[model samples]
Target: MDSATSDESIIAFDKWLETPPGAYVRAWEQACLDKMVANIFGFNAVQIGMPQIDALAANRMPHQWLADIRLHPRQSGTGRAVAVTLDSEELPFATNSMDLVVLPHVLEFSAEPHQVLREVERVLIPEGQVIVCGFNPVSLWGLRQVRGRLTGSHYLPKAGEFISMPRIKDWLKLLNMGVSQTQLGCYAPACRTERWLARYNFMDRAGPNYWPYFGAVYMVQAIKRVKGMRLIGPAWKQKTAKAGVPVPAANKHKESIDG
Candidate 1:
């Protein structure tokens, strides 16, 4: 999609957050994020995109900031805290500076998700943790999304590339990061009404236990790895020679032959 269309799609999706399905997903994500980020101690933490979710609300970092391409001088009201308006593919933070990063559905909306992940790898320090939330493309929600797109009435954002969990893991592995933890939630069907959604609450218990990999949403925690490798071998020997001085090999046969 073009830039204008992408922007409109995101705006429409943000407005949809007020609806029942959107609100349900937001609550699930917030609860998951709270449990994951509460134990991570950091000096600086950044939450990129999805400013409405408040991904760092449970974090105890001394310096917490939210960044998004949509945040601007006019649309500065990003929930509880102010957010900086910047592209996720090009963050302004220094290299190896951020201790933690939270991406709440940013990759799905980004036109260049790989570039955004690369930028996240760049700004984070070694062993820094990154929490990513995404929609699983192999579940009931995924089926609904596909049907919605085919019918031209998507429940989620229409103009995003909904990436799979395995694909995201591969991307992280290529960046020298390892997945530390994985969480799956929101097993209910994509229902527009809260009453119908609550009716399928039993699926929450059954879905994860019977079909572990079929959750509608997933959260992955990854850590950047900095391997320390050193070369071990014999040290090089040095020989000193002064001007007009011959370096002797200390061989008696050479001396006797010369005499």
Candidate 2:
């Protein structure tokens, strides 16, 4: 999608986030993110895109930031958290600098989703945690999007590509990251009204038990992996020397004379 259309879709979705279904999604995502980030200790954490929800709110990391493609003029009003405006595909951070990175629905809305993921991998330190929120393409909401495309009346924003969980996992795997968790939520159908959505709330409990993968949204947590990496120290050196064969006094004297 063109930048204009993409921005429009994002603005529209941010507004929609205030709607009943959107509100439900926000609440669920916030709770999940809060729980997920609480244990992720790091010096610097960056949340790329989706300033509509503070993805790093519960994170205890000393330095937390929210970034997007376009900087918000009134960002200072948002309080202690720093806000940056930069292209998602070309992040400004140093490679392997961030300890935690959160992408709240960034992939589905991105025009260059693969580049964006690559950028995410670039900025994260080894073993750094990444948490992503996305709409599941095999869920009730996905069906709605398909119907919308056929009829040209998208219930969700038209700009989003609505990536599937498997596709995302493949992307992470290709980047040499191990997925640690995949959580499903917002099991209700794509209802237009809040009353209907609330009435169908029972689906949240029933859907996961009966059809776990059919939720409207999913959260994926992955860790960057570096192979053949190990830690060494003075103690390890001392232990290796003790474990090796002892040199004889005659050999030692001969070696010292040769030296």
Candidate 3:
């Protein structure tokens, strides 16, 4: 969060904008994205605040939503895309309408993170899914967030700190989004040409797991809870009743903190 380090991050992001995402990293990201997208049904696939990569993902998986700063000239379905930009808090859709939404570092770069999340919470169905990917504050690659911004874009935050996964989980809990799973990626330094170093399987596992302190990015999947969360299945209760007179009550709260 040093002033000088902040400037450096900004410079780094500028460097990134000058190039596209690395092929290996992009492939891994797309793999994870595909898994998340495939789980939804009759739901909209929304990629917020990342028009370029969202477009890429859309192209890779034609079923995924394709977004852009401007409407796509050739694709008439561009009108179906929820046209939004940085600072656009109000969604054009109804409550509980969206089935899936992807936040590709929008939380890290947004000037009003909470408001954006609130918008997400508003549009999500009770059983909706949201996948978030962001720079890990602790990773060598996460420290390069400033590079994620375009120079002079007011959408970026002015401060810098490790945006801890735990903190994000807490925020989602407040928004009624339950944490389902998390994965860390790019634990080593961001090297475009030196990816040969990660070809070894052992280094890949150790870095993203044990050495997450050096990760470039991390991902989390959260789901909105349904009302009337059941303590026991109906069939289980009937079977247990056949064998016992009473059912013992136990701890009622279960939470995931790997936010």
Candidate 4:
């Protein structure tokens, strides 16, 4: 898709977030993001897209920004404002400057998903963390979405090229970002209305223990790693022994004279 088309799709997806199914997904994502970012220590953090969700609200970073390709009038869940508007494939920040970056459903809608991740890797400092939320294409929800596409209707946004967890892991690996943690959620069946979703709510409780990997949504946390770099602690100097030359010479002379 072209940039204009991609932008329109993102806006559409944003609108979808207000729907019942969308709201369910949003609530799950919000809770997960809150827990994931709570303890991360950092100076600068940036959330790449999906400003409707405050991905950094629980973070304690001194500098946090929400960036998107274009500004939208909608405020985030916590009323956090967008700090900058820029292309995800080409971030404006300096290389290795960001301590954390959150990408919520960004890859699925982007025209150049790999390029977006490359840009994120470029901006993140070594050992910095990145949280990515995406729709899993290997679940019942995914099967329903596929069926919807075949039937000329889409369960999720047609513009989204839903990426699988393994694929995302491979992409991050290629960028030298190691996957540190992963979470799967939204085990309920893919239902269009709130009523059906409520009926299937029991699935959410059992899914984690029965079929954990088949959740509709997945979140991954990765840390940027640089080769041949090691952190060092404070250094200490060894104490030197005092010279015993004068005492040794005098003792030797006195022993010889006595002999």
Best by lDDT: 4
Off by over 4 Å in 4: 71-74, 229-259
Clashing pairs in 3: 9-146, 12-147, 13-147, 137-162, 165-259, 187-215
Compared with the true structure, all predictions reach lDDT values of 0.84, 0.85, 0.59, 0.88
Model 2, span 103-139: residue lDDT tens? 9888877789999889989999999989989999898
Give each model a TM-score.
Answer: 0.85, 0.84, 0.62, 0.86
Ranking by TM-score: 4, 1, 2, 3
Ranking by lDDT: 4, 2, 1, 3
Candidate 4 on 1-259: residue-level lDDT in tens? 8878987888889888888899999889989999999999989999877877788889999899888775454466667777788888889999999999999998998889999999999999989999999999999989998998889788888889999999999999999999999999998888879999999889988988999999999999999999985867444322222333256788899999999
TM-score of 1: 0.85
Query: Cα deviation of 13 in candidate 1 (Å)?
Result: 1.5
Of 1 and 4, the candidate ranking higher by lDDT: 4
Number of clashing pairs per prediction, in order:
0, 0, 6, 0
- Higher-scoring candidate on lDDT, 3 or 4: 4
The CA lDDT at 87 in model 2 is 75
